[model samples]
Target: MAGRRRSGGWRALLCLPLAGAFSLTALSGCGPVPAPDDPEGRDGRAVQRMLDQRAAAVRERDADAFLATVDRGSAGYLAEQRRVFRQMSAVPLRSWTYRLVRTGGFEPARVGGRSLAAQVELRYRLKGYDTAPVVSAQYLTLARRGGQWYVASDDGVVDGKRGTEQLWDQGTVDVVRGAHSLVLGVGQDRRVLRAVADTADRAVPVLGHVWPQEWAGRVVVEVPASLGRMAALLGASADGYRGIAAVTTGEVGGAGDETPADRVIVNPEAYQVLGDFGRRVVITHETAHVATRTATSASTPLWLSEGFADWVGYRTPGRTPRQIAPSSPTPSPPGTCPPRSRATPTSASAATPTASPAPMNRAGSPAA
Candidate 1:
């Protein structure tokens, strides 16, 4: 049997607290003294400023500037920070940003006579390889030394201790670049990788023609070696995603903002079972999600979203309604279309339906 195409919705996942994930030693240094209001309040502002400075440094790609915000007193922490910067520098980045997702007001602890420690949630994205930026979250430790704040430590695990591998950390990756698309794969068969690249190349132009003009035409596809690795990328468990063909994920920007980075991740096991035509159809459908993600919302009907994707994927192909419907063991009723089908005219001049359509339930089934 052919594997089913799955459409996974995008949403933020909160997995664990920051302190439980990693350990860091308190950092201390010397700086100018502050006025005597609430010392904790002043330290909070300083920590915020430190985070802002660190974010700017990443965007600027300045190694020295980025390190200035780290605790200089901790040699081991400084070395780790330097290594991270070096790795980031080697990658081609379109943009990088970090925002503090506060769990609560900063809880300051007096570590020593002059040193302090606090915790905050950090949300960050490093957009590279022309795909949607992989959004990552971590709980971080900040310290006050001298009179300025510095990042003391962070839980570098992308998702949690269980998900220690980031995209870069996944063994060796081979990148296939096209005019408007980038395909990355790890431990994948070279033949399959090339096939995915070819499919994406063809799908991009079709998507450009079919989707709204406002969306950026670029697309990124990731083919992980195994379902376990793909789940790590998604910050989920393998069991939760079994039998899914592909899923599109990324942050949705607010109105007037461009769509945030989006990625189409393929299920290696499920995708491998598909024939050539099925492969293209699945790729085009997921690419449609990448193209239309910015304009889509929770309120958008699933039929419209999935139907439009199917429409684009099946367009110009000589496939019939029966061929396009989801495979089932039992036969479908004659002349009764699939619940999700939106009939398209056989030709431009074909007659249109004049009657009002029946209401559809949340599952896309016609209301009785």
Candidate 2:
């Protein structure tokens, strides 16, 4: 089943109508505040200046300048930056309340020699529809260079904890077990979980190679409630593990009881497919993988895992499988999986392959 891809964090925001039009050329900096120009202090100022400038560019929807300031070398840094912008792009800024906070420590950044690393906290107010006025404490690293400051990173910290995922839409949600009711605020979370779980159950069969039925009795399944939530979960997961891992929603830590044979964690984002009613189809595709034990390792190729998932997902009722596009290279020989039977959608909404989609938790584990 094809699903509409959520915008990739910063990279996607860069392409937005508003963000892509403005041009920000004037750089931000403060004149000499003290004698000798404190490199550490200067770096801090530089980073802050960059942060403010980037914010303005984002507000102004200035594409060129935003990209120029950020260093794409660090994957985590890039992803984090993108995630914030993606939300900003979706939710227009109504107003902002900025207050000085604190910097716990200072160091130097390896990316650019001139930048200093200091953790600074910012208290601000964000207003959006459906969401209450959000009072947040954001954490950021400031770097000093030459005589200016640049933001090394913004961790999206709020009230000392990182911000939750910013979900954009929750439409036509369905739940399998509980009588899930959708409320606007806190109650909405519970529904998100229930609906996501139901989606995962529907997905189990579609991810065949990774989710063979042999382990069905033992494996535990998990799902993230919203798309925004998946970002934080992905961040936590990315702290460890590498390569293609899926980051779905829900809490961290392990099920602790299941063995490799019995546990399979599902990506709640897979539920995004549900938006088009193709969710059950897509989840089955992913679940099939979990059941099959298909994970990171050169042994299992991307095309193979993806193609297999698609194959399993196509089996759902009402689906008409079609052959893989001639444009794509088959992971296995053409005959390995059953011939595609589902009629492909007029416009495919599949998530494009970027760096691996999944992130493993700190324990060096996927969200099983």
* lDDT leader: 1
lDDT of 1 at 64: 93
TM-score of 1: 0.62
lDDT of 1 by residue, 38-104 (tens): 2344555666677778888878888899999987766777888787676545345666555544423
**Top TM-score hit:** 1
* Predictions: Cα RMSD each: 15.8, 20.5
Cα lDDT over the full model 1: 0.59
Model 2 ranges off by over 4 Å: 1-47, 72-88, 96-100, 104-109, 122-133, 154-368
- Cα-lDDT of candidate 2: 0.39
